[model samples]
Target: MPSAPTVIQHPPRREGLGPPIAAGVVTALVGFTSSFAVVLAGLQSVGATQSQAASGLLALTLTFGAAILWLSWRSKMPVTLAWSTPGAALLASAGMVDGGWPAAVGAFLLVGVLILLTGLLPVLGRLMGRIPTALAQAMLAGVLLPLCLAPFKSLGTAPLLVGPVALCWLLLLKLAPRWAVPGALVVALAVIGIHLGVNGTYLPADALVPRLEWTTPAFSVEAAVGLALPLFIVTMASQNIPGVAVLKSFGFTTPWRSSMVMTGAGTMAGAVFGGHAINLAALSAALAAGEEAGRNPGQRWRAAFVSGLAYLVLAVFSAALVTVVAAAPPGLLEAVAGLALLGTLAAAISSALAEAEERVPACITFLLAASGLSFGGIGAAFWALTCGILVRWLLKPGPLVRKARGSGPRAPRQ
Candidate 1:
């Protein structure tokens, strides 16, 4: 018999709660402030009034916070959960569904049902997995392009309002890459304040209180095919699956069944209160799972736990944040939203084009998505994936893929 493979195990990590606690704080801050604007924009796109949108924001924050706490504690892993930012970006691009807000809410409920079924049925997860990574990423990149362009576009239309926000983002990206978007948001708020003062804008009293608004859901064929399917795909492809991969990188096995079940349930519960979707944290998962959280993988779950508590604390101020956005000059907050999505868009594009053999198919997907094409009841995302995959199959590569595994792997992105 071959000699037993040498077993390697990490030395016991030093005992300390301080590092993980601090990491948790940073994780919450980065996770919330970085993409809250995207959440607001996405809700608005699907026809949410400002008050409804704020309620949606609060619901997502609370539900995911509770989910994270439960999962991390039960699984003993840094199992972070978040509102699906890419899914939000998709909604922002997909625009109003055929049946308006109730239909959109109904679609959100549909996404929840699908996600729950995915958890209960392993085949569903595998089926989603069969969607080619290139096409999926290409669709995401396509959805993101227009939103990402808002910053530079605003530079022409509202230069004074958006210019300083962009400058601050650029400056901090070099000094502290982690804080760039949040920093830009701060500057944008300041600009909004000046604008409000100059114009004597009066903020409504109700905008300062955290509240929940319930919308009775009503499904439509259009919303089911267009809004729900695409949202589910984006959350699964961009956030939930990648979140598992991220924790695995740090040597923690996510409890898949429990995670999906909890997140799916959370999504459904929050949808009645106007929340869109919640999924595993993709990028933010790293903040709680990485070595910065603690040398010991065992203790890092604490970081995720603390981060959950932090989100609940943050939820108290959701209405105020929305109030600020409502008062801001149009395109100013959108400019910040664009800045927030830049990194995600760049990563998506890189991943979509990683395989030299798949570049053409990916481009087709991207262009169709960006073109905002819709047919029948379906939107561009579904059509983009359909066309790209069909094109990819018809044009299979024989030679170009020989070295793709070696050459196309993204050292940074994955």
Candidate 2:
């Protein structure tokens, strides 16, 4: 027989960086625009003044932006980082600690320390893993419940302002779920602008410029347990661990030790300027790692690197964005924030109630979190986790954890 013709496999054509660049831009915009209001709301709830909250937003944007740049560049793994949206929701529910804004800042610092410890100690990471997924998710859902109700609550009071935003959210949610919150936010900004124009309120002269304000940290036992511990747990369970899973699903491995250290250190530094927390990006990581960035996985890190660059650019507008959001008619921005979190709330609920046997404990946890119950100056989030775990153990008296890889549960998509 004639020798078969030799065949050579050819590599994919280079798309000239356009695809990755575009995906990077989308990732940054979606990541930043989607949950920034929650960050502002969370900071304000924990005793930050509007200017301080603005500073917090600025700090978070800048720190995470820098972290992503360094992580992607060093690892070339499309590693991205984000402010912890669930952590922010937890803060929004926790309210002001006994130590006030300084206390909240201290809690943020402690959360960083915990993240660092988790990276350095395998035991600690496993301890975190041992928290039953149902309880952990239930705790997150509970933390989110009150905030998620804002849009509907606003409908009863400020329908004229909130209705349009809600409508925009609904339309996009059905048509393009990814853009739903951002679309709603745009509608809210328009409403704010119209209301401002009619009422003759102009944005502050300095509001357009970004400012970083520093606060001295004060550690309190209450803040530590109430804010810091829960913040760390939520960030780890809901962001970092899932971020690893996300990258893995796309055939990549996260540099867990290095990323934890970087994000931990970055969170500590940002806390001084009033940020809450930062962690590996979860939902948004897909944008960079997916085929949309390019068919070749090796080059996808460019998408993330470019996203980090875009975030740095967005950081410049953080203060201005906060100012505009703050200027909105009451409840308008809350509606937007609520809309932003709806998907998260749904995911949390689903996960928390996934196992038939775990339903009762999860329900109790959810109710406590939603009730915003506080005792001994500790917020409900901590207590909810405690109670849920206790209930599960008391009721079943055995390992209740859902089977998964060596990590906590994957969080709901942001």
Candidate 3:
């Protein structure tokens, strides 16, 4: 008999809770401040009432909070979860459908089912994996372009308030990159407080009470093909795929199927309360799984648990949270969001342009996606990818021609 293969395991290591606690807090703050306003706007664009929007926020936080806690504990990894920010952006751009919020909720449910199916079927996962990374990144970049421009555009309107926040962000980025966004958030809050003191009673006092609202789903063919399909594609391509990549970069073995099932379940739970979608977090995951989270890799899961606890607390105050976000100055919230996403935008652009042969198609995808075009009720993101793939196929040398020329099989680009 052949000798048994040697088994290797990482040594167990644990540390004091201080680092993990800090990491958890940072993760929570970054996750919430970075995109909560966009989420609220997305909900309202689809005709959600103020109460419904608050409930959506609450539902998203609670569902993902529970997921982060359970997945982290069970997997012994820092598996942070977040609402699908790109999906929210897509909703914001798409506006209302014929059936209004009910139709949007139906689309969300359909997306959840699709995500669940992808998890249960290996073939679906493999198909998603085969989507070109350059095109996907280009599409995401296009989706983000308009929102990322908000900071500079706000300079003319709220120069005094926006200036200091931008300045603080830059200073913090240079001095302490990890705390840059939080520092910018602190500045925004300070400005808001001063404005409130001068302007008087911006936010309602009773916005603190937790409220839940439900909308019965009403499916539409337009929404199913337009919103549901695009939401599913972006959530998987831009969020879940990169989320897994983040974990792999940190040396964690991803349990992809289980994560998808859990996220899909969370999305479905959120849909009943008017939330759009929830998925694995990419940026926040890095903060929780990085070296800064803990001295011992084995204990980083504690950070995710703490982050989940913070999310739970936020959920309890969801009504107040939405009110405060609503009270912010026009364009100010977007400025803050834009600043927070600059790094993500940079990374996406770089990734999209890295492959020389794919550059033209990627650029086409980016331009079309950024155009915010809609056709037959479908969003530009879907069309952008389709066009890019078509362009790539057209530009490639034909197999028969290559064989006639005595060239061997061409190697695929990464």
Candidate 4:
């Protein structure tokens, strides 16, 4: 018989320049294409000037990127951070009512404080632990599903550009999942080039320039109830919780509460700098946690630090970068994001329903989560858990003791 392949274990090494650079690029692109676009749109919808929105984006990118790098290095873990996309959506739905930008700042500050408090309070963390895992997974998947679907819809609007990209994605997914995203992006760019060759559409050459202007925070009960609480729920239920799960899936068991504490502290720091919600980034974690990050878990933080430095650079030139990124064809962004997320999506679903008994609860959570239900300023995640728990309780049968008593213990035949 052939000998079994030898398993070689060696100390982790610091990844070379190439992997860190690649990871940084992936992190930056995902941040730009995701809520960074939506946040700009939301702010614009609320009557904020373009400059203000651009400033906010700059603030978010720098704060989150720097925080991730710092914390990941300290913890010796590849802890990637990102803005809470669901929180941004909640902001969009609430619109820019009486307080406008000031309220947003105020809400961000308040939520950050609350998150910090959560970290300090062990009782709260214990309570969160009591919540069933299936429910938590369901809520997270529900929150992220909308984002995953967006890239596919772009094909309808720009078939000539998006179709080729989608095909490329499928091929890569089938043949080589690891390089699918960058590969799809290359194919999309090629398609764009061919179209431009025939129709002669001009692309922008201007760079994004960053400008900073601080808006004083205004606090009100309405803002607290309407914006702050929702932001907290989304950040906690939709971001931090799932982010920890992602790390666990990869077999890393860093202190969960400590990570939360850092994330909360980071959110507060971002608030002071005029950014929106910030939390751990499950997506970016994949970049640093990949085999390329380093064989040794201890060294993966380098990639995150590189990403952080890149974020700082981008923050310095926010306006120019935003314009340049915005000019990219939508298909290029969507196909790349979708291909990148497929693996994560599969892993999440598998973990969400690992137990057969938990499947029903998981299903309930998934449906409620996917429903995008909101009420009285609270977003879908909180409500989905509530509904899922209720269903689980209602469906549970009566205690076996009660059943035995009712049947008179098999008529004492024994």
Candidate 4: tens digits of C-alpha lDDT, residues 1-414: 999999999886645677766776666665544345555544543345666777777778877877877777787777778877656655544566456678777878888888777788978767756777677666656655665675678877887777777787778778966456656756755665676567676545433447666777888766776567756765776677777777777776656666667767777776654667778776656777776666666666677777777777766766854554445665455454555555545655787799887889888887776676657645455677788888878766679856875674345556
Best candidate, TM-score:
2
Q: After superposition, how far is residue 247 of candidate 1 from its true place, in Å?
A: 0.8
Instruction: Identify the runs in model 3 with alpha carbons over 4 angstroms from their true place.
Output: 1-14, 400-414
Question: Per-prediction TM-score, please?
Answer: 0.92, 0.93, 0.89, 0.70
Give the candidate order by descending TM-score: 2, 1, 3, 4
Pull out the clashing pairs in model 1.
none
- The reply for model 4, stretches above 4 Å from the true place, is 1-50, 85-104, 145-147, 175-207, 217-234, 237-258, 272-274, 289-291, 295-300, 316-318, 325-365, 372-382, 398-414
Tens digits of lDDT, candidate 1, 1-414: 799999999996667899889999999999999999999999999999998999999999999999999999998889999999999999999999888999999999999999999999999999999999999999999999999999999999999889899999999999999999989999998998999999998888877999999999999999998899989999999998899899888888889999899989999999989999999998889999999998888889999999999999999999999998998998987899999999999999999999998999999999999989989967899899889999998888556675674586567865
Global CA lDDT computed for model 1 = 0.93
Candidate 4 Cα lDDT to native: 0.67
Which lDDT tens digits does candidate 2 get at residues 37-58?
9998899999999889988888
- In TM-score terms, candidate 2 sits at 0.93
Stretches off by above 4 angstroms in model 2 are: 1-12, 397-414
1 against 2, candidate with superior lDDT:
1
lDDT for position 336 in model 3: 80
lDDT of 3: 0.85
Which candidate ranks first by lDDT, i.e. highest? Answer: 1
- Better structure of 1 and 3 per lDDT: 1
